[model samples]
Target: MAAERGRPRLARDTIVGWMVLVLFVSLLSVVIVVRESLHVSVTERANADVTQEIEEFRTFTRTGVDPETSRPFTTAERLLTVYLSRQRPGSGEVIVGYVGESGVVTTSYGAGAPDVDEYDLTRDPAVLRAAEQGTSGTLDTPAGEMRWARTVVDVRGGDDAMLLVAVFTGEGTAEADRTVRMLTLVSLGTLLLAGVISWLVAGRILRPVRQVQEAAAEITEHDLTRRITVGDDDVSGLAATFNRMLDRLEEAFRAEQRFVDDAGHELRTPITVIRGHLELMDDDPASREVTMRIVTQELDRMSRIVTDLLALAKADRPDFVRLGEEVDLPALTISLEAKVSALADRSWRLAHVAEGTARLDTQRVTQAVLQLAHNAVQHTADGDAITLSSDVVVDPDLGPALTISVADTGPGVPVAEREHIFERFAHGEPPDGRRHSGAGLGLSIVRAIAEGHGGRVDVGGTPGEGAVFTLVLPTHTPASHDHPEQT
Candidate 1:
């Protein structure tokens, strides 16, 4: 069930859907605010125009009085009644009324106007203020309510009569309402169109990301050579970096495979020798002696191979153990010269001496030196001169290094074969025409030990001349002892 659910989905579509949702919400909020503001502005302008017309009419009544009879041409109620009756049009109405100082016995105009008792002019603060100040007052009137605006004008006569102008103010509100409804419809349509366009644009932008994800999903250890194809643009650089990472992984994988194969091959020979000796032991007592000796030899070889393999593996580890102690190169060379002299038939010389010192793993360093000495001896004639020398050299690139060289009067290594000579299982014919007995891991093991100590081995020779093998290690101060203990 989990595997089935892990199947890849359309990532581009998902991104586009979320983008469109956010855009729709943002655009909708802006449209709502704009529509509301436009409606309010339109209603305010319409109310101002209506109020101005009322003021003009009031001014006419105030100034147009008869000078001879000392009376206005028409009464406030009669003139307002005729004016408002003519002003009534479709979807709107107008009315006129009067309120005296005592707030009673008022006159009204227009047939559709509500009764004066029902219209609470005194209860409304704005209307009451307008009546008291003899000015105009405008109030917001919602639909389904008896709403209006009133203008109070005082007459210019001694009778203290007043003119009151009132209009239903719903016309401007209705027109604004209609405009808002139309704008809302148009905004919703725009939002829909914008959502569709945003989805398409989002899909276009996200398509490359989806393609990269798909290509990544198809990659595996067995098929890491495959790469994502991209255009020669910014996206292509990303692909190139990804491909480089894959290349490193592939190289690491191949190295691991080679290690396994080499290890198996190295172990097989010793196991076969042991098995053959054991199988022959059950047949005869005379053959058992030879078989036992053969078994012992094979066991020794196996021990050497196992030890070398462990050392190589430890060198590769990040936290490989290190035991540092001061060691004298001249003294160590003297000990090795003595041991090699006792073990071989040839004469060994110690020359070009330097009293240099180093902090090193004494036992491992001695083993590496012994291996190089043995290798030189194996390639030399029985009577050839073997020399072990020490010198302290300061190289411009490498700083101070204690150089220990073993030179033998043997056939030298060829130039083409020099690079591969340090690799495992690399053996060539010596000057004496005798080959070494073991798998060619001696030089490889020596190189590993040198590298473990943060040093290196250098080889130089000419054809038919002797080869000089030098082990270079960083120099240090000598310890105040006869000989340091092995690490």
Candidate 2:
């Protein structure tokens, strides 16, 4: 118990933890993918803008005619100066021209614009070398990061020069960063909410399991009445099944208790009879012989009672009847008449024989029929007609059924006693006004055999004329035949 209490609550917290982790991983992946895509998009757009600007410069130089003079330029300085004067850079962009060792042209636009000297590549040897090579890359300046693309141009009668176009990308990158920050905040809030919801939902789902555990803890051998309250969700099926199991357990326990009670009650009479006879026996030989006979008879009666009680107890087992055996109904019925004919001095007759085969436990069916015949013999006098019959009939709910009946020319059972005649220890009186000598479990055993075949036993006949005890069983083999028959 202490170990069980100390164990982790894996069912509750572990489920919640896994849910939160999956949500966190999924949300984080989305954020990372979005951020990377946005950053890549910003860099690509800036690169395209810079490339476009450089391409325009190359296209103008190809014309070889100055836009301002409408004539061919004589020197590279004139060409460079004329182009720089005609240029209009976009927002957050700059245009610079590096002409040999002593000439520089610069233009800037947008807010926080740096002075021309700050971007004058003439002072920076690395920048000038990179620009001269027509390279494309990023550079950190007083105006923040810039993406630059450049091209070197060699014109006749002029110093070698380079044209550089740079786009200020700090604002674009800052916008992307801001978007990621907002997404991160939102995702964190959503994760928090998801964790809370997951915790509650996990608890709700596991509540039934906890109830089953608690109910099991409270239940004992003497008390099997605890049941889980069922709901309509998927988990409710488990609770419903558990309740059904409990119901069967409770019924089995009650049946065991009743069997013990009935055995004690019934066995007391024979024990008292034997004890009384033994106590009253005298020294005379005749008296002693009579007492011994009485004692032996009582002991035999007790043995029969014990056997009947055991049969009744075993009725609830899965293998009470060995089903799936094909037996000819007509032959089985005729054989029943032959077997029961010697039970008493009554007139035993075959009334009808069904002309078909059925899968059933032949031994159990024969045993039930013989018991019915014995019952009929007890109910009627000698020369009274006892009829045995079998037939194939159709039950509306059960399809084809095979019915075997034992009918007697004796008083029929009263309507009031029919309901419980199949119950254990329940009995009906015979016509001779003599108490029955055998245990009352004969009909119960018969009913058990019928039910084991997924069928039923019923009593039907005209009142006071006769009693017809019929066993109605399915003609086809039952699905429960998968269980191996017990020896």
The digit string of per-residue lDDT tens for model 2 on 1-487 reads: 4454322257778988999999999999999999999989888888888898889889888886976678777666777787887777765677788777666755545453455666544465666666656588887766578788888788778786678787877777788999999999999999999989988888787777777777777889899989999988898787788899999999899889988998999999999999998888899999999999889999998998898888878787778888755788878888888999989999888878898898888888888888889888888888999998889999775679998899998887877778777877777754444566677888988988888888889898876889999989888756874345566
List, residue by residue over 410-487, the lDDT tens digit for candidate 1. Answer: 887766767688887778655545567776778887888777666788888775788888888666422321233333
Model 1 RMSD in Å is 8.8
Question: Which consecutive 10 residues in model 1 have the weakest lDDT in total?
Answer: 477-486
Q: 88, model 2: CA deviation in Å?
A: 4.0
Candidate 1, residue 257: lDDT: 65
Q: Tell me model 1's lDDT, rounded to 2 decimals.
A: 0.64
Off by over 4 Å in 1: 1-14, 43-148, 158-224, 227-249, 274-286, 310-371, 381-406, 446-457, 471-487
Stretches off by above 4 angstroms in model 2 are 1-8, 75-78, 110-126, 132-134, 141-144, 159-161, 429-434, 477-487
Q: Which 10 consecutive residues of model 2 have the lowest summed lDDT?
A: 1-10
TM-score of each: 0.61, 0.89
- TM-score, candidate number 1: 0.61
